[model samples]
Target: MISVESAIIGLFSFSIVLLALSFFKKDKYKELENQVENLTMIVMQENYQLKKKMKVLEEELLGNESYTVPLNERYETNGK
Candidate 1:
């Protein structure tokens, strides 16, 4: 028993509300995207620094004369 005019008006009002709600969601999504990008950049920088430190440690280990000798050799040399 609903009139066609009232039904049309109700549908139009519902569509308008849905559209407005979508606009609010869009802003929140954009803000979350920016935050994720910032976090990703920070993680990338830390990874690079860790890699650099690992490379330095590898070089130091390779250059160390003491490490060139085995543990058994160290014990034998010490026992002599």
Candidate 2:
């Protein structure tokens, strides 16, 4: 048989414990958020670099292909 005053005190104590637990968890949450942000930035930078490398490779392939004369043209030039 709990009295009304005892119930109120028990509820108040439970709320205080929850508040303290939340405060402790908030710091860990912030640290995890920061780690995720850092990983995202790293991934973005790597993606940009890969795109840049692909562009350079595409340009080089196009340039190399443009320099090759046709087989007939090569034969005619060499025969002359």
Candidate 3:
């Protein structure tokens, strides 16, 4: 027969252990979460830089006199 006092102690101990295990899980993944966050930031920055470069390239190409005209312009000039 289990005593009421022992039952209460056992329940309290189990609750404490469950809480500790939950904390341990967070600690274990803390490092991995930081790594993933760092990687995401890096990728986003690189993507933004690439977009800027591409926009500059497009503008440069458009400003170049020797760049080919669109096919529609070619057709218009040819049909003139």
Whose lDDT is greatest here? 1
**Models ranked on TM-score:** 3, 2, 1
- Per-residue lDDT of model 3, residues 1-80, tens digit only: 99999999999999999998887674767799999999999999999999999878877976754335776886788799
Q: Which scores better on TM-score, 1 or 2?
A: 2
Q: Write the per-residue lDDT of candidate 1 for residues 1-80, one digit (tens) a residue.
A: 99999999999999999999887774667789999999999999999999999878866975754655777897898899
Best by TM-score: 3
TM-score of each: 0.56, 0.59, 0.62
Question: Which parts of model 3 are misplaced by more than 4 Å?
Answer: 17-26, 64-80
| Residue pairs that clash (backbone atoms under 3 angstroms), model 1 | none
How well does candidate 1 match the true structure in TM-score terms? 0.56
Q: What value does the lDDT take at residue 20 in candidate 1?
A: 91
Residue 24 in candidate 2 has what lDDT?
Answer: 73
lDDT of 1 at 43: 100
CA lDDT scores, all candidates in order: 0.86, 0.84, 0.84
Position 69, candidate 1: lDDT: 74
